[model samples]
Structure formats: structure tokens, C-alpha cells
Target: MIRRLARFRQRFGIAGRKVAVRTELAWYWRWLGILVILAAAFALAAWMYETGRRFAGFDQRELQQQIRELERQNGRVRDELKGTREELESLRAATAASESRLAIERSAQHKLAQQIKLLERENARLREELATFESLLASEARVSKPLSIHRLTVQPDVLPGEYRYRLLLLTGTGRREQQFQGRLELVVSLTEGGKDAMMVIPEATGDAAPAFRLSFKYFHRVEGSFRVSPKAKVKGVQVRVYEGKAAQARATADATIE
Candidate 1:
């Protein structure tokens, strides 16, 4: 029996030899390998998602900053518009005031012009009046100091056989206090019955009513109307002034009748 067991060990090739052995893997080990692969894939996907989230945060911050800058620019534009409106209102007010002042100045200028014209006219009128007054003073000076007949005039009266005469008798300035009383007589030449004849106006028909009486200090105006014969045509007149109701004449003047 020992001899036959030794023969069997030798025949099975395990008598004194060392050799390696292999066996089929278990099912649970295959499942564990698959779980490890899936875990590695999940971990890679999580790392990619974290990187993308960081990039997105940076982009969002930049966009917010851009929006804030746009808002600031809009506020500045609004302020500029408000200031422009205020300036426009100021300009309008100044223009209106200037126009009003200009209108008032124009009105004042027109009034001044009218006043100047009135003053000029007044000056001219005053000059004319002065000239007329000076002329009168000159005439008075010329006739004031002489004892003479300054003027004589004669004219036919409205009556058929009458004549009128006028004379200006001037007294001397040297004898102002010596008052002179006188009588005036007029002598006229006429054609009566185809012959020259002489007649006296206001003749002394009676001593009670002498020729026209005259009394003066500086001057006297003598005037009279007298009648001649109806058949007489008067041609000339002579005036004589006598002193103090006397027949002796002091002055004589003559004029022609038209």
C-alpha cells in the first residue's frame, strides 16, 4: 500500500515541485472597479463646473460696473440741460429791460426837440418886439426937443365946400416949464369965379371964439374942418400957430390938398 501511494504522488506531478496557481476573479471585485471609474469621472465633472462658475462671476461684476458708469453720465447730461434753461431765461429778461430803456430814451429825445423849437420861436418873437420898441424910441428922440411943426396934412372933406387939415406942433425941451398957450389958423387957396382966392379956416369970426385954441407942454395935434364958398375949389392949405391969442404968428406950415 505504501509503494502504490508513492507511485500516485509521483504521477500527479506534486511530489516535491513548487508551482504557481491562478483562479477566476470574484463578481463583487468587478463591481467595485466600475464604481471607482464612475467616481473619477464625477470628480472631473465637478472641477470643470467650479471653474466655469468663477469665470461667470467675473463677467457679471464687469457688466454691473458698466451700468453704473452709464448712469453717472446720464446724471451729468441732465444737470447741463437745467443750467442751459436758466441761462436762456436770464438773457430774455435782460433783453426786455434794455428794450424798455431804449423806448423811454427815444421819447425823451423827442420832447427835448419840441422844447428847443418852442424856445427858438419865442426868442424870434422877442427880437421882433425889441426892434419895434427901438424904432419908437428913435422917433420920439428925433421929435422931442424941437419947437416946430413936425407934420402937416390937408384933405377934402365929405361936404361939397369943406376942407380938413392936420398939424403936429412940437415944443422945445429947453422950455418945458414955460407952458405955451396958442391959437391955430388955416389959410386955403381956392379957385372961386375962375380966380385964385384965399380963405381962413376957423377964422376969428368973433373975439369970444378965436381960431382953434391950442395948449401943450411937449407936443400938440391940431385938426380942423372948415367951409368955403360953394363955388370954391381948394388947392392948397397953410397952417399958422400964434402965441397967447395974438395975431402975431410963431410958426407956419404948408401942405397941398389932393
Candidate 2:
């Protein structure tokens, strides 16, 4: 009985053991508290980082504004560069067109110059013929030959080994009313293979015989071309006129090639 009483006192007495009284929280409230603590820690860390950046003379907002401005400037520069390239291409195309026009103009000018030269040569020839006619009229007595050749010219033609000949044939004034019928011949003197040679144009039995036939009155102009061996160099040419089937030449003219 004494032991049981001592045990009860020890169990219920103030000196036995201290007891803590606590209020129980709901599960949602506990979760809300934990979330608030985490939010506060993140806010404190962010604030510290922002303060450190400010102390180091760095501002995120200002840097971002600078980056945006630089991007705008870069876009403008690219546009300017593209415009410059387009202008360069346009200039190149215009230059090319101008060059082409210049070339065409040059070609036209060259052809015009050639035509002017030809006209000048024709004028000079006409003057020479006029002078010859005037002299013939002035000295009728000196022209004893019934038939004559004047201003015979032989020159190289455009092609190699080709030659062109021009001559004026005149009948005596006494025979002006009568038409003359004759044939023409050319004798070419040349040097071939280190030897002097002579060749006749319109060889006998050749198809060019009709071209040599002549029927004219008073005056006639004869112009023709002939070809020879390319290897031969012409030294001189002689023109002969024969009346009817006569073997002897009635009039002859000679021209030398230099």
C-alpha cells in the first residue's frame, strides 16, 4: 500500500515530467507556410543579386535598350548596303550599254569614212577623164591614129592573184558617125619561179571570149577583172584592140605595176 501510493504520486505530481501543449495545423495551412518560406528566400536572393549588379555599374534594362538600338542600327546598315549593291549593278548595266553604243557608233563612223574615200577617188577619176577629153578636143591634128586608148589602169583587185583593168577607147572624130566593131585582148607579163613569163587573158576557146567582144561608137569604157597564178607576180599589162578577125592589133596600150 505504501509503494502503490508512492507510484501514484510520482505519476501525477508536478515534478514527475513536464508536458508540452501544442495546437495542430491543417495540411493546407502547413503547405501554404512552406511555400511562403521558399518564396521569401527566392526574393531575398534575387534582391541581393540585383544589388550586386548595380554596385558593379551594370543595369539589365539599360543594356537591353542598348541591344535593341544596336539591332535597329544593324538593320538600317544592311538596308543601306543592299541599296548600294543595287545601285552598283544599275551603274554597271548602264556602262555596258554605253560601251555597246560606242562600239556601234565607231563601226558606223568607220563605214562612213570608207564611203567618203571611195567618193573622193571617183571624183578624181572623173576630173582626169575630163582633162583628157579637153586635150583631145584641143589637139585634133595631133590625133592621127584612127583608134586610140587612153587612161589605161591595171591594179590589184581584192583577192590574191586577181587584177582589175580599166581603159577608155576612142575613135577618131572623123569616124564618130560610124559604129566600130572589134575584140579586146590582155597580155599579162609576170615573173614566176625566177623566170619571166607572159600569159593571155581569155585564152582561146575559153568561155570568157564574149566579154572581149566590143561594139561601140566614138568612145567606150572597158572595165574587167582577171586572175592569174597566186605564185606569180605581175610586172606589166598590155591591152590590144583588133578590128574584125584581123590578126594585127590596131591600137595598144601598156600599164606598169609597181
lDDT of each: 0.75, 0.90
Model 2 pairs whose backbones collide: none
Q: Candidate 1: lDDT of 235?
A: 87
TM-score of 2: 0.72
Runs off by more than 4 Å, candidate 2:
1-18, 26-32, 43-84, 141-143, 157-160, 194-197, 206-216, 243-248
Q: Where does candidate 1 have its weakest 10-residue lDDT segment?
A: 133-142
Task: Output the lDDT of residue 123, model 2.
Answer: 90
Give one digit per residue, the lDDT tens place, for model 2 in 1-258: 999989988988866888899999999999999999999999999999988897896879878999999999999999999999999999999999999999999999999999999999989988988888778756773257789998899999989999999999888877768889989999999999999999987786733388899999877889999999999999999999998788899899999999
Per-residue alpha-carbon lDDT of candidate 1 for residues 72-133, written as tens digits (9 for 90 to 100): 99889889988998998898898899899999999999999999999999789558546644
Model 1 segments more than 4 A misplaced: 1-146, 205-211
